[model samples]
Target: MSTYEIALDSKAREVEWNNAKCDKYDYMISVFCGLSAGIIDAFFVGTPGKGRLGQWTDKTADNMVQKIANMLWTGDKRSSVDGRPKNAPDTLEKAISYLEQSFPVNYDARYGKDLINGNAISGMSPLNHHLLSLAHSPDIIGLLFSIIDQFTGKATFINNGKLIRLVPVKDARNNKVMYMQGTNFESKVFCGVCNWLGHLISDLCGSSSTRKVGKTGRGAGLPIPFYNLFLLMDLGKFDSNSFADIAVKIFEEGYDLRHGAAMAIPVLIEELSIKVIWALKQHCYAKKEWKDCIPSAKHADLRMMLLIGNATLCLVDGIDAAIRTGIKGGNPITFILHLNLVAWARLVMLVFRELKIRYGSIVDQAVGKYLAQIGLNDAYSLKQYYERMNAIDQKLDSVLRDFTFKVEDDYKVFIQSLNYTLNSSLRTPEQGRDVSVAIAKKEGVKSDRIFRSQEELRYWLGEKK
Candidate 1:
């Protein structure tokens, strides 16, 4: 048994024995936390179009877009008469326009017709094309596709439950050219990446045209991160639209990244509230150490509480959606719009986490029972045994090393004595014969079987024969 194995076993045992107990009070607290979060979600994040939080997120996104645009702005810096830099974007709309002209792509298809290629992309339009195009997404998938499209002069889009690629055709009359402009491949990739980011920022708060119409309506914005992936799920039928179509419709109606941010607020509140409350209860009521009071998921009680809390939150959200949509004559779009996808996602994650923890516990318990039957259940005893074994192993290594040195020293001494005897007896044959006979007796050999003369002895010892 190695020290590493012993330590690992000790840690496993500690984890198994230290499982936190959740009482009825814990469950009640979790439910209360969830209810509180649900109320916030209902009041603040109602729907994409009219939710207070959604509006706030939209403004925040607009601010972010302006900031990013200003950073990417590289036009002439000459000052204008108004003291503002010439050709510089001052507002969100101007910033968006600046980006549009800076990073023009060939894949701006609208209404089933490619803007550059003149190819067909069914179910695509200015309103929902961003949702259908993978490159328009504000995620890694989008970044990769954006770079690829720039290099290939083609666009990738998901339409009618299939992937579509459209290549641009040359127009000799206009002769308007667009390509990733850089000195090298690396520079070109960098330019592509920048172009992708700049374009997404321009579309973050909606197109410049929509912004020009003022704040009376929700403008078309980029879809939520990875939300475009929903297009692959071409399952289910709601009214006349498939699930994929419904997803696109949802995005077109203001359920974009800004609204997704709004939806995250309640989920964050629920998570933080539970953790803070759990920590307070542990430290104040339970009198636990500060380190132990941390509400980490590693603690069994914390995991269970989180699972219960999120589940309750989802329940509340579902009921609220049901009631609100029912009042609107049970419109499918209304119901879908009112639904809190973030809460449901959190609940699902908690459920899977709880199941995994329970399964692991079961396996650990079975193994522990078998170990206990063999009287090897004590971690301390096992650790001590391994420690002792390691000590003995180190001592044995030292002893063997010393013994080897001693044997080598004794052999050298024996060779020196033999050489001395051979050199001294070289003058007398009889003396050498007597020495040989004596040496033969010591080696358990008969005198007659051994070398007799000095020369013969010298030959036997590897001297010139």
Candidate 2:
């Protein structure tokens, strides 16, 4: 086949080689790994508040907030001896307060009444306003809205199946106009990004005001990453609450970024356990190369195993959530709160990805077979093709070298004879004719042949057709 065809075939083989198949053994092992992780999730990661892992994640988030607060704390309110800010807001609440004062935004509207006029956003309250407001999300959506709010001096909110933008009521206590800092565009972006991050960090746990009030409840906090997307999904109605309302309720029940982090634990456990086992099996049992044993998503076997494993985990989590919620009189909100949304989301993604890969593989196999039937099959392996090309190149190089050496030697001899003839007497007509006859004999032509013109002479001398 042609080089191009060979190259295309080689690439197809490479892809096929990478997409390793999963056997029944692999699937069983993956299920076991998933079951182990699901058991941990059901027992340790029970619900938002009641689960031990959830509490640990909450404490970890608090510590993270405190550390961030300490970093953002620029006030001279510190004890000289211990280096800890003494009575100057060292706790998470105080740190949040410092961040609030340092990076204040105009969009601190809590309720619909907090707007300039009457109620604009229905059901808007301190508890759910953050969920409705895109800026309060601890993800890319939040970053974009935060930057936009900072520049436009307007707040953006989504509520009651609508997106609303409004001029925020100015804080009469602090009349300072919020402006983007820095001299250049890049510096301004930097300042905006820093401001956005600081603001989000401040709101990550809960508002400083709410925490300071000493209310022992899940106060308003930043939503989980990308959880704001659910606000757009206002279709479903579960027990009089729309999907948006359910999302709000979920956030209200402490399924914020901290709890999201907690939910990640069991998902991660299942993912890692499956990957490790797959890699080990590939290397030890399958006798694959170390490099080939990597559990990348490109491998069909690994993807399938991961799909099965995460599916099992989600299944167990669902059952657990159902049981817990059934005991609580089958409350939908309780069921959602108990469910591991992270695992379910992962399983959905895996399903789509696996379907896509399988579809592509089927198409590829059909195309490959058709091409092979048409005699377009690759004849030479990549290595064999390269070796043959190399041999041909070497042979051509040797032939060219020999031809070059002969030309050089012939040129030298012709030049020396020309020089000798120039120094000697001019040849007579008879001598020139005799010389032509001798040249014809040397060139293996008939010496007695007569030539009429230069063209005829060239033809007789075998120099032209």
Candidate 3:
């Protein structure tokens, strides 16, 4: 066995049969992996569920903000999700049907094709798609809601030099918009926009990202309120204008990366690691031949060790790159400290991955029984969601499965028709894995799978097992 495989076996040998301990490891890994994907999903490519809400699903924050800023410069009203068409934002069909007569003069030519082709961006990575699968899953919506609820809070803000606490005020449409006490911005500013009756507003014109939290008011040393990103969502459409709405809110809130590297690095690394692990996990489960290959507990442990070990190595390399970049910029010592934290965290995850591989089934059974006995269920909901989504993706794959590029010169018409935006960038196996790992670190996306090299083709064909 390889050195890493031996280490994994050793770690697996240290597993204990404690339900609580196993649950802790399970939660840790899932949260670290899932939340990383969730945040990226929430930010970059708002899932269909969040997109239906007109949230930040258009593009990356930087992309959206820059595009909108350019549009604003050129007086482009046709810059919204659906452009200047008379379509409601509630539905995708209407959004597309109402595309404006023309895009902005300076708009990227690709944007027009992307918008019309319904492929504004490249397909999401496997990890991102996995999180999105959960996002769109009816079963896990409540779980996601609960996770968001943990970070939900009423934000305290300063409006027109007056410190005020926000409270929700329902408009005639029954949409809840937060209001500030002793303020006339609702009647004065917001009323002019919609002319609704008895509408109120907060003092700061609207929800401020630079707001305070529960008893401890905003101050010089207080940590930035990351939760406001969620709270602002509750503030309704008035709070959302562009994808950058959340990004700007996060920036304006407090404790930027430069200011709070100590606290920030871990949060960044944790999220980064989550994306890495999630992308790796998808490949592990994607092996159809390996589905029943995990027969014995030992076999399962070895498989998991391979999965976790690869992911950990990828994450270590990513962080190591960041560390090197930081060092060259004269921040070597500070980066060393950050690297130490990541190293420790990496060790914990490896140990947990091994133990979970051994005792995970036992923990699952215990948790299942406990959940059933208490009426709190859906222990396998995430798995079910992934399977359903993967099935759909597989059906789409079937349509193209027979079209091998080795004889591509014969079918011209078929190729032209298949030029849709969704799968424009097909991958060879070697390129695919490298792209998967690289993009997962750089963009938090997993792109599509590619199998070109001999070993990879064998793996993809299920001949390697």
TM-score of 3: 0.22
Which tens-of-lDDT digit does each residue in 250-310 have in candidate 3?
Answer: 3333222222323333345554564455344434743423333323334433334334433
Looking at model 3, report the run of 10 residues with the lowest lDDT sum. 197-206
Taken over the whole model, the C-alpha lDDT of each candidate is 0.77, 0.76, 0.34
List model 1 lDDT by residue over 223-247, tens digit each. Answer: 8887888889867888887888788
Cα lDDT of model 2 by residue, 73-164, tens digit:
55545455635444556676787787776666767678776666527785788888778888877788888898887767778898776778
Ten-residue stretch with the least lDDT total in model 1: 168-177
Query: Where is model 2 more than 4 Å wrong at Cα?
Result: 1-19, 74-88, 171-179, 213-215, 360-465
CA displacement after TM-score superposition, residue 334 of candidate 1 (Å): 1.3
Pairwise TM-score winner, candidates 2 and 3: 2
> TM-score of each candidate?
0.69, 0.70, 0.22
The weakest ten consecutive residues by lDDT in model 2 span 415-424
Once model 3 is optimally superposed onto the true structure by TM-score, how far is the C-alpha of residue 227 displaced, in angstroms?
A: 9.0
Compute the lDDT for candidate 1: 0.77
